[model samples]
Target: MPATPGAFLGGVVVSCAVVGAFEAGARPGGSAWPARARRTELCRARQRAGSGSAEPCNPFIEENELTDVGLGGLMKPLKRLLSALTGPIPVTRSRAIGVSERLSAVTTLTASLEYLNQRKQTQPGGLNHWPTARGVHGRSTPVTRKLLDIISEEKTTLTLHAARAVVSAGMLLPGSSRWRGAGNIFLGATTAALHPRHRYGTDGSDQVSILVQTATGLARFSARPQTQDALMWYVALQANASYFVSGWVKLMGKAWKDATALGGVMRTKTYGHQPIYELTQKYPRVAKYLTHGVLALECFFPVVYLAGGRLARPMIASAATFHLANGLVMGLGRFVTAFTSMHPMVAYTSAPRTHPSVAGRDDRVLQVGAVLLAGAASVAGVVAVQRRMRALEGWPHSRWLTTRHGNQLQYEMSEGDDESLPVLVFVTGLVSTSEHFGWITEKVARDSGYGVVTYARAGYAGSRRRSASSYHLAESVDDLVDLVRGVVPEGRTVVLVGHSLGGELARRAAVALGERLHSIIYLDSSHPGELNRSHQQSEATERIADGMNTLVRSLNVGLGILMAQPDWLEELPANCRTRVFAQYTDARFWAAGRREWAAVEEEFRAFDGKLPVVDSHALVISAQQTIDRDPEQLLMHNEIAEAHRGQGHSVEKVVLEGADHDSLLTGARFATEVGRRIIEFLDQAESHATSRVCVVEEVGQ
Candidate 1:
């Protein structure tokens, strides 16, 4: 009977898994035979040393002896146990030969077409601007530079064109001589080797696909059956090694262990795709689980391939799914086709083979039990560590209010006995937690004797993740509304204070609040037009956020211990400072901040050229230091103020001298003055409202 493609894929997956499991379970030098051989060598050396020769004892053997009693005896049974589990099954040479030709042809042809498509999509000009090419131009010898340029340009063009022609010819004439395919394969491989850097100009995956196609072509053209088998095995081993090593290397990183690295990658233009990026933003736990899943699958890929039979099929299916998802979400078009081409080699190599050992059926059961035990222990350890960390770092003075959608929103409030005083709500800027307003929140509450509110947005510190369906701006506004209404007493108006992107949200809230809105105070607030003008600036911010998240996750403990208390934090109480530092070092805080920044553009567009219409006076406080540093930003601030003034609302514009954007809130020299000005504005607004009420009452009488 002829073998199906599905069966071939299954065989490949099983082979990979078995090989991986074998590698994990049986370390090369740890087996009894190898250990005994080492011991024998050591005894000879000791005898030589006694006869006046100088030789050092094996450190590994010494360490093993110290760690375990009768190390060789203990490992012997375990080694035997693994061998029984991994014992090969019977497969005929006829079956192996039957699949090899078909599988190789399919893999080669698919890879070739994919490579051609990649070249078309990423035009030749793109290769010229790659970092590797630029480096070559700067550092390479004149002759080397010319050779590289020729290889990058002429060779790439000729190889791609030739490969495309061969694929097209093969499709039209399936029985064409193998010599033609071999020639095309040689041309492609030579081109890639000449300037390996150029192959990855647009996507690294393309290089893998091109190389696989060349290898397959060579194997198919080879007259010797042994040579063909060797070539197939080589491709299969390389693929398995790539997955295993990639997974192992990622495991070494603290970012991957904590599952925060994916979030950082998603924030970059190169790797971030909106669908998957937003999915991770909405459900960070999903990203965490996905990180673990990818690592496990890659690490165990060799085991799946080695397992053969039904096991290989599921592994192959899973690998396909992974590549497909990555291709669509990350725009890595070449990965889907490139990696899939290697599947044939995996299938061919994984076919069942007869072994002389008569492994008992009971040994299979023992192998299953051993695998389950190991898997269980790994899961339990991971859970225990995560739970311990979470328990150790509990939130302080945390209060949660359930929104209409049943999501919990966290906020901190300070109130005075005065009911007539307007409630002051402070909204923070992009990537900022409520702790950012600690000093300002304290100063305002202390001096004014009025109620003040500071709350974290969704996915931020102490706040639960928002509903998946909720848009960033609407969700933010809804959460703010809930927090205010839940906390503030009835019949009292509220003042909205916003900083940076928070200021933009305040403007949107002002429009929504209508009669309930008291006034708005903008502190170095983001202008509506700013988003349109700051593409490069936004990219830089994303990069900074990525770096911060990585640093925080990788050194959470070290940073917590080493971080010095900033001068601005001194204004906060001791307990508050500790809480602030804790939040600063958290991966969640950084991830939430990145999501907030990512949504800035969409949030800015939600206004549709409409300004907030508030009956109360509006205050615009621009930092003079920021103005001097960026004249364009100052002009934007001025334009925003003038636009408000033109709208017939009572708008006041003030520039705080010697204060930069952040210094307006944090600097000791300017914070007091900034607070005073804010209080004065609030008091004046209240006075004006009272006078208007008195005049209206007199007219009515």
Candidate 2:
């Protein structure tokens, strides 16, 4: 076998009739190309039927609305779907499916071989353990969990992988055309079914494999040549773009630019080779040249299309060699096969238009260019929508205030006719926006008629930090204080509600506010000493803090498009959900978060003394799941409550059942419960203060 067997095999396919078919528009297995006139007529009919129009989808009632109607409501749509699926498969589709199956067989074989080598990790309690490694998806519905469990068993997983391997092997053999489609179908299903079970120990290679398999599988069933061509082009473009983006991202990093990145990676235990690290150290100049060479190759990968595809062969060879070296040095063997599997498609797409076989073919390269342009335009449209969502004017009555220190903060203030009640001011956690407290803020303002104020901290949302100097924990507290003083009415006492790191800042602000503060509510707040007190917290801090800078760099290089939308964002009220999502996707938001994280990590690491407490009413609300995950955090909350009690103040501690730190604010059910508990605490505090005032008047008389 060749050192890069996948690429070599792919090259073989493109060198034969496959290339003639792929470039000249013919059916697989040497079938003659159909008449272009007929293809044009079919496309015109599709357009007339409104199937190819650019119009928006017709609005229809949601699925829930049909549930109570009867079986007819559901059966109507089901019948339409069945009719569509049973339609004739076009010759173009059949040809595409044949080509897709041949490529997918190789991908499936390489993937199964990689999984088989790591079979031990798929068992219970291993690194890639199922059910336990589901992460946040563990909270999925009972039916979903039951379905997941079916394929999560050790024997079932191993059997499916073996079956997929056998199918792929059979499909790759000579005279196996009769079983190719069915085998590809089976391999596709098995690959998807086993994905979630082995999230651990998987890398970019696994992601690339999944992407290629999925795109090809979809193209295999598409009825239109245009659709198949677009999907194939997407695969080829993605393969090239991945290399380009990765190179630029590395360029953004100081270590990569200075040629120290290779040495640093080799020194790590996870993806490292000690011998390579020692070699880099011994011959630094040679290492520098090698690193720069890699940067040039990756950054210029897309140049393969230049000079009528003259650069394609050598570029593909260099990339294969790079993956081969990575496999040998870093144990990333799957990367070699997974990435190489796309080279044939890349070669086919980038081949010169004037090639004899492609001379009379349709202008596929021009059509593909139009598709690329449309995609870029769509991205721009989404960004425009995001800007509209982020505009402060979109939020009614939202106002901006500039503090004395020159930092600008955006805040929303709501108050009913009532004037006697103390204003409720909310402070969100690090990297969080005021939208996090939307539920609680609305509930308090509407039900209790308490004036409510929620503001974004400096450099968050619409807020602006005054300078680009180093950030500190105290700077945020100062901003919070400035925001409070600027927004609140004169002579009105304030009730502070702080969540996460906001809780610690609120404590300091409460001391600063003196008599102007009435009560404090802490919502799953951070403790000053958590890094030292909890081993889990200490480990998590190191890992998260180390990655913050890299995350910012990734987002800055336009990789934010790949960031998955958070489930919490969906749970927020419909009015503010888009706004929050806009900020979440914005690279600037993450850059601000990274700056604050640096200060926060530093402060947590150097935490040495107890936090100061005030002689005021306080409520410490802990999430049950937070305590369950880290028991020591509960102890810290208790200490906070005790500290306020020691200062001769009224303090109550309550745990919100089934709520985690984020869910306390994001989950509607949990946030409603949290809101109710907070209202109850506020009422009790009001009554207590009233009783004290009565006693003081009586004593004066």
Candidate 3:
């Protein structure tokens, strides 16, 4: 008979499986036949009819039988492998039907009850007004506001319906196979729907636990009587895969491997129990051992399962005990129930099967192919979604302007029609994007009625990189001058506002601008003397910067999801906070920040003893509550103020009490005060300029 398509595929799959097994089993060793012959000779000698021998061996036993010495050892492993590849899969017979049904009922009831309790405590007032209740209202953009509200509603409704369906179906008709299938289907759908909302939840890992349970439930429902064991085995394999992946990922992190992460987590008030926290603190070595033990168990879970029988039972018990301990220590009661529900199924599936062949090898080949295809599709889907999200969030759409050096700079401008008002030109500190001044810029533009502009320097944010030779202070000043001249209206006077290292660039630009400058305001700005003093970069600082750059680039996506808005930004709309956070996680932002740190010493030294002879008014706003505030820094500010006065230019100094350097720009009270001070200075400067023009005209007449 000619071979069919199914047979051909089966032949190909079996060939691949055999080759893979051989590759895995091959190792450097003596001849297999010689080792078997030696073992057989020893066994035969021991089995010989000796005068005082207590143990007996049957003459009918073959030489190969001697190799299977330890508790069904080598032969059992070989049989299990053959079974997995081509033998009949174990099924739940009539006697085993009630076991799965009972387990499913208990899991459904426990999950439903716990979910209801969680909803009462965490969600409050159900789905109605949930977005506003969760403090998600009044977003800066309407689209984001609507999207957040919709997602919240969908998640709440899906979870509620799915939990209710599973509970009702499992409890009312536990014996009914159709109802069991219905419950599993609903639970699986719910798990799929909740995947995207995991990050939004307080316990993301809890959601993952529930997802595993859902998979086990679905596997039980869809599997046929004969193939059910195979499906269950696959689910157990998934559980082991999860543990191994999580354990290995943690091992990659230094803190987790060193046990510090375990200690830190235990000490947290929200997630930690009092007993565990106290115990970990009192006995640090215990914490270290516990951490290492968890890593070992999780990483070796699959090995234990493969060993089967007595070896597997202890490890399985340990996993259950570990979950129970977590429940007690971290108040993760749901995880205990959710994960424990799957344990019995995993245990049952992991046991050695004894059954004759019922299905052809072609079925096994198709099953393996389907699993591989599904896994590949899942990975591709995740990559596609991530790329789509990045595109939708405007990460790729950079606002560009050609600089004097032909480099494109990214920038943002606040819309305003008030040409009469002085144009507020903002320069951000090193490594920061134009969006760093988001809240302050919006407030200033609205309150002061000034056209505001902020731009990312070359190689920062979304801007194109500059030539290596153009990274110095002079090149930066030239870029700033061109940006302001091109963006600002021709007749409008410019008010320069510089924050941190931006102050250095502002001072340099002010000198180059000469008469076009209306006034300069420094908000907790860096002084020339401070820069010259700290010109030589310390190795420690350099190491810290390098670490930050690496971390930001590698974990940018995760950082974007988990970042909380600063306390100062609490009053801004939620969408504004989201936008600011997205910019913070941009790889270009970190790269540019590192460059700024690298060039700062040289840039500062280049401008040593060269202070701009400012004919325009100057205002210095200093933060009083800076943690690293030096006495010399205060003296530098004072000296700069005195020098402006000495030059016969109007100088004003405003000290903000209880405000840190960042808070000076973002804090609600401080930002409002800063805005008021800037308005007052601009008004006075405008008045003086008007008077001087009138006097000059009168003298000429």
Candidate 4:
């Protein structure tokens, strides 16, 4: 890269032009993309958003519209549900009936395993530190207690993360905000707690001390917006761009017609099996409308964002939602951060490069060119972070980073709720974590009286991650088995929700807990049957594999830079350790991703099997809108969900009337509606079962 003696000025010029051009495009009079390409992508994005341009959804609907049922109105529903929970847990009773047949002379290993766990009070020193984590982590230290409280301050992770966005307006200068001083306070405090000498613990005390310190530090830091805040808008831009581009490209192709790609995405082993087909079966006429609407949202979110003004707000809001859903379903990064990073907020948060009360500071800008350059640089940094975070999630520098299941697993959980309601243990898929499901979990708990537990399997975010190796499905499965047993406990009525790779795990969880689980939900899930047709042999496989390599490697270089900039790392105490370890230790996950990217680039790898052969009953939530040129793939999503519904085991599918695949999670109506439905399903299932039990006992007695 050649340096421009005064390249800053030149960049400003280009930025000005781009902004102007973009603004012009926002107007109805502006030159539209060759309608063929423009319309195709736009439609696809809309479908992905699940909005068929229908009476443009009333995003202003009150929250009460969805959850405010009068006590009298709710009593009937509650009575019906109580019957369900008391009913002999179907599989449990059956299994219990045959317990004698299964209770052979207890094997020595089984006895030992039982003895070691001892109801989670003690454990083997090295095998699984779950018991230890429970003792050490469950009971937060004073410091940890503080951080946990701070995290608790956030009702949902999305808001917490969104609050971190430091998109200083490009027009303002830095240091203008006293918040920079606040940044100083937080950064100074954390530097000592996270100092490498102390943090890279060589002994057990190091582990205990670091955990305590980190917990306290995070509480202190999270109390501010630093952790979730980190100018998250930077990352949001890249992630949203990826989302919109992916959605639009797919929609622009012939795939848009059938909703095959969108649907298949839900059914891929990567996403798990979405009950898209079930929704189609429930609302055959309206399903496609939902599919196309979602596609269009995905297609043009980028454009809406770049265009700025009123039009951009909805797209931005929806994109934010999309990201939150991604967190919930697939277990990706923070949604609010990912969504705001690239959208209109960039201009305002970045312009003047000044924020009224945000932390962190750099030089102020005078010229528009300088502002654009700064924005551009910031934007680039965001992109760089996105590329690197994947690697960061799989690092081994931290002990929790190495927890592996089937290959890899990510977990997400609701806020402090074990005491609040019955537990709903959610098993997430690849590249997912508790943060993803933050919003959904909150919605479910709020709308329905239930608690949820989700987490990063390992090698994801700051939870447990992979060691030096990449994740594998089998390993991830084992992790799931262990995590569920340890965290959720057995014989509890758990409502399991899985998405993408998580769906498969959800199935596994259902299999493991059978009677313990009251219901299973697949949110745009992946089906094992949808394995890429050629597997390792396909070109798409090669492309995806290759890109992942470059992405992570580049990220490592960025992490290396962070390591060198002790000040910068210190300033980022909330995520410093996470970022550093992810960059340094988990080189392989990114490497594998690179390899996959190289094989297939970003193109979806079609799977032949499409879905796992299973007989378990579950609820599937799918996106049915289409906004693509090639429509078949998007259409297939609904069809597949429908086919599965026919397999018995009560499957209920609902179409997000104005949503697309990507936007549904973020869409105002979808989040409230879908989340509400999930809550209802759990309640009904729990209630219906309990009541059935009462009648039988009464009759027998």
The lDDT per prediction is 0.60, 0.70, 0.57, 0.42
Least accurate 10 contiguous residues by lDDT in model 4:
692-701
Q: Which candidate do you rate higher for lDDT, 1 or 2?
A: 2
TM-score per model over all chains = 0.44, 0.68, 0.51, 0.36
Better of 3 and 4 by TM-score: 3
Clash number for each model:
27, 0, 1, 210
lDDT of 1 by residue, 545-633 (tens): 55655554543333333345565666544556656665665556666666666566565544465454345556778888766766667
Higher TM-score: candidate 1 or 2?
A: 2
- Could you tell which candidate, 1 or 4, scores higher by lDDT? 1
Per residue, candidate 3 scores C-alpha lDDT tens digits across 328-418 of 5665544444454455445445444321121221125237847896876666556434533442244344456777787677676764667
Q: In candidate 2, which residue pairs clash?
A: none
